[model samples]
Target: MAQTNNATLIRREIITRLCRLFAEGRLEDIDRIALAMAPRNAQTNGSRCCIHKARAIIKYRIMALLGFNVADETDELESLYSYALRALAGTDRGEGVLTVVGEACTSCVKSNYVVSNLCRGCLASNCMVSCPKNAIVMENGQAKIDSLKCVGCGLCKEACPYHAIIYVPIPCEESCPVKAISQNSEGIEQIDYTKCIHCGRCMMACPFGAIMYKSHLISILHQMMKADKPVVAMLAPAVCGQFRASYGQLVTALGKLGFADIFEVAQGAELTARHEAEELGHVLATGQQFMATSCCPAWVELTEKHLTQLKPFVSETWTPMRYTAGLVRDKYPDAVVVFIGPCVAKQAEALKYPGVDYVMTFEELGSLMIARGIDLQVFEVEEQGAVIPERQFAASSGVLNSVAAYYSGEQIKPLVISGLHKKNMAVLRRLATGKHDWNMIEVMACEGGCLSGPGGVSSPDVARKLFNAQSGVHTEMLVQ
Candidate 1:
């Protein structure tokens, strides 16, 4: 996964500012967000062409945050305040998971390996010699590439002495693992929902801030403000590493945000592990070759959409979120359950289960904290329950370890898929052919697991360190 860049920071700022406006009871001024961020004659960020362009981009982003997909808008003159009114009213709007801002898209050139200006036209001509297609040649004191003959094999790029040969890629297109993103008739980027796994790679990859996921912030906030019924937060294990405070302090922060109660999803993770272990034992005993973990909704959706052959191999056990949502419903039947996690797939997953009413990313939660002026450092840490083994489920191998702690039927051989890139996906296809010897497989769509999800607020490495400090457990160990 790529590091956090200026694009992400800008989105975070907008979210925080919008939430602050709502918290301050000045939502009537919502349309002024763009003007406030980019006043007339104000110096624009170096990224855009001018202040007006920057403001248009900002307006589209706000539109998405207000649960309105910019692509669905027929009126170019629609005001941000109008969208705000519709969002708060929760009427006459379709809930879209993802949307693209065509105005913001730079429409990156077709992906190719080209010779750059830095080419020194070295005497040895390593680039020319290394080109299998003989597509590179010396001209005008710089190496030139023959577009028709170039195959994009990157051999010349590696052979260049001055590193002048470069491969320029369409940011959103290249980041997608399943080839779900492509260019439309006008050359603007478009997503194929039929092929997209909703792994959220494109949203995080776009340097131009063109792609966005519609948010349910206004709907969730409205329920909290009414205060007629319980509003419970189902916090995921990844929350342990998102903030600078202890788990208890994070719980207190949620309470201040009008949560009547907070339940740990890890509590449900423990039950999921136990049930999955039993299912795995039964599968192996019944002569099935292996079983795949079904915790990652993206991976599960990948099977349903792209990898149909692997669907049967996936365990039927419900995810921690589902189990947790069920628990909340059984306890408080009238409560509105909001799942808080570092996941984009959770939004799609929540739609399948009625127990969960909404899903909020940790980035969104952080913005709410900033908006409401809730400082985590000063809040007294609420006393927490005993930490369980399942608390380590935030990391990549933690799921397998938790299952290993419970499975006693047979000695297990584990295969862990830490990230779901193109190459790893091919391996999964081969696995479904019943040729592999591994008895158990665990997959996380993001590289380092839920901690590195697109919605994560902190880096996976830092998140792992903080989580480890609290649990004092070796979460990376796999089954024998």
Candidate 2:
């Protein structure tokens, strides 16, 4: 297995250096900076892969320049252009650095939304009136704040007759299931990193693109290029939806990027279907009323921390991505598995689970492809057979459909769960306490399933259209 901790440290060290370089105004030395940071060339180096390292370094550097504070308008082009001009100097031109830089440019600072521009200077003063304690005050024809006495009860923001008093929320904090995000004196969203489950929905909700996750693309790529580790690419089902291009074209592009083979996470979905079906049988046999699918990492993590009572109900099968990585590694002992999809939760998933070495979202892959100037439309590439997803595949009911296809007996009734938010909490509560009677359950954290994940590219509708087009090819029997 690759030493993930060591690789992460290397990434941090390089970013720290680049930060210092920027501060020194040696802007012209960007090429030297890229060369210095590139994954060590495999020919002369011991373990460094220049492409992978360059990708990691560039991403962190761009995040740093964006101030990493949650706020909107962080999606501006200057941040990307600046990083690109700096990273693509001389020898390191056309490297994976742009993947990092471009992604950073697209990220937003997820903030706790504070109200802006909609306040009413009303006479009834319902906002102040609603407060049990006098926390709100009106001054200069506007609502003024006094944090000392006011509890964050939110009554003033909620009770305002005009809906004018707005509550600004921190991006990540707002996205957290538990109210873990609290403001420090400085008004920055202070993360209880310990309390955080690493779900990364905040990274998605943030308009300013401030939040970031560590990258290990360089380390994995280096291993593939130098170690010749029979690297396999396991693409998630949501991938079909993210790209505007044909799915075949995207697979061909990955082949060109030097991946040894591409496997659909949908293949693993088949594995999940088989395993979960078996588990569901065992659950029913043992007189357990309902079994929940454990394949969705976000659902599992949330249930573990917040819905501990429901843990016993989750299915035991590994997720589609993990299942695929495990299957490939078993077949190819030297394989270094790279899972490409649209889930940030998968990054956290890789850290906890074995088999998977790296997780790159479609967003990241798009950046990588663009950085290399590989145009999907014009590339003369070979078509690999289409890979279809089986389990909790796309958005709503995707998993339910797969489960139904695999199970033949007893007329099973399965609950399809999506949108793991406060509103969806009631359903889980019902399932755990026996308020609902279903044979099985399929849950997705995002409202529209994996395609709507924080790491997703393209829209839900676009991804669905692509996925539907590819569904007919899997008429053959399942892979053993």
Candidate 3:
């Protein structure tokens, strides 16, 4: 519950309800049962104006969970039961990784600046004088913002001595690093997939829970329930610190959830570390500029879509998830490899790699555990004999450390790009212009690396400590 956000809780409830219906073989009755249980009564209103409207929103959420495109106009008039039947029939998968529940979007004001009641109408007129765009004006003894002239530079807010000026950012727009989210003509938020990196930051930032991602939970569950072949669970390094239970217990729980085998993605990270280190060494030896790590799918996408100049310099190494899935495929040719991690971008990344059969976030996996009634605390820990990779790979500088450890004899001049913010773009621009001095660069789109991933279970602070402790346990082994 510590990691549970309002959005995460809502998603969990929807998934849990779907799983219950699936277990009871009552998927046909999902719409009626979910609506009844969601609002409980006419008095049980949620974020919407009434319980009925709230239930309507929930219906779309259930549709997204079933892999249906919530934004598809063709299904605009369809019922939730219809979508459920399609999902059960295994025919309709969503067209995109992200979608907006237009009904849930509150249509907040588009302006980023607002004149607050705290404006004292001071005679000094510091706010007025500081406005580079002359966006601030005084009327009726109160400060006002001229939306037409306001460029959102925030100079007026900074200059106001009374701190009366307030910056009211649209959460989704502000959180999106690439400015992919914008308001449609109807005032509903729409994502431009061309610019979107599938990072899920906008989804996490929206307070109204308006944004959501298409889930493959039902598809994965169907495969799990069938049990025709092996289903391998590939856990990311961030998994070490996700839950209250120990890692061993979590592995045992996966088995109980019908996974035929478990593999640590950290093993793949170890392989990536060596591969990246060697690649970096070769690049440096050949007198090429610095090489950026390509482990983060979002960062890779950001370069491909926006920073086209930097794409060629990005390391060609596969991410740990993909590399691990490849190994899983080599061993079990017909196995379903599910990559479980904190990354939402991996959902999109999985689509590009045939080795990966499915991708589920830590939040989604938590819901699956709840729906299956698998209590991690009570599960007996199974002895896992696999080689656990360096846990530092879960945090920002971990990749640098991993690659440095791999090339211990060389002096690896490293640059770390902790997050994809507006300021960090300047660095990438500099790198593109051949202005940087480093031999290797580590870039993670999410601040503090994968532990701060949008789909992460624990907060970055807590996850960092847990990941550090785990890293220390096998430090010597990792170096070897």
- Which candidate has the top score in lDDT? 1
Model 3 alpha-carbon drift over 4 Å, by segment: 1-3, 40-46, 88-92, 118-165, 382-387, 408-410, 469-480
Off by over 4 Å in 1: 1-3, 92-96, 115-165, 382-385, 471-474, 477-480
Name every residue pair that clashes in candidate 1: none
What digit string (tens of lDDT, one per residue) describes model 1 on residues 1-480? 324678777888899999988878888888788888889999977889998899889999998888877788888898888888888787655544778888898877643787778888889899889989988767888888886688778888898878888889887887787888888867789888788788888988888879988887888888898888899999999877777878888888999999999999998999999999999999999999899999998899999998888899999999999999889988999999999998988888998778898889898999889889999999886665578778777778899889888998888889989888777877887987788799899998988788788887877787777777654354774532
Off by over 4 Å in 2: 1-129, 138-143, 157-171, 379-392, 471-480
Q: In each prediction, how many residue pairs overlap at the backbone (N, C-alpha, C within less than 3 A)?
A: 0, 33, 0
Candidate numbers, best TM-score first, in rank order: 1, 3, 2
Q: For candidate 1, what is the TM-score?
A: 0.90
The stretch of ten residues in a row with the least summed lDDT in candidate 2 is: 90-99
Kindly list the per-residue Cα lDDT of model 3 for residues 305-380, writing each as its tens digit.
9999999899998888888988888889999899999888898899877789888878777877888898887976
Tens-digit per-residue lDDT, 1-480, candidate 2: 001243333433544454344435454454464456554553423332446644444544444332232222234443433543433321122211111222323222222223345666678878778776686678777666566666667777777767776666445555667655455554544455545555666645544343455444444444554655677898887766676666678778998777888887888888888878877787888898888877778788877777888998898888888888877887887788898876766766887888897777666576556545578988553554544546247556777677767776576776777776766767787777787668788787876677676655555556556555543332221211
**What is the overall TM-score of model 3 with all chains considered together?**
0.88
By lDDT, rank the candidates, best first: 1, 3, 2
| TM-score to true structure, per model | 0.90, 0.72, 0.88
**Cα displacement (Å) at residue 321, model 1:** 0.4
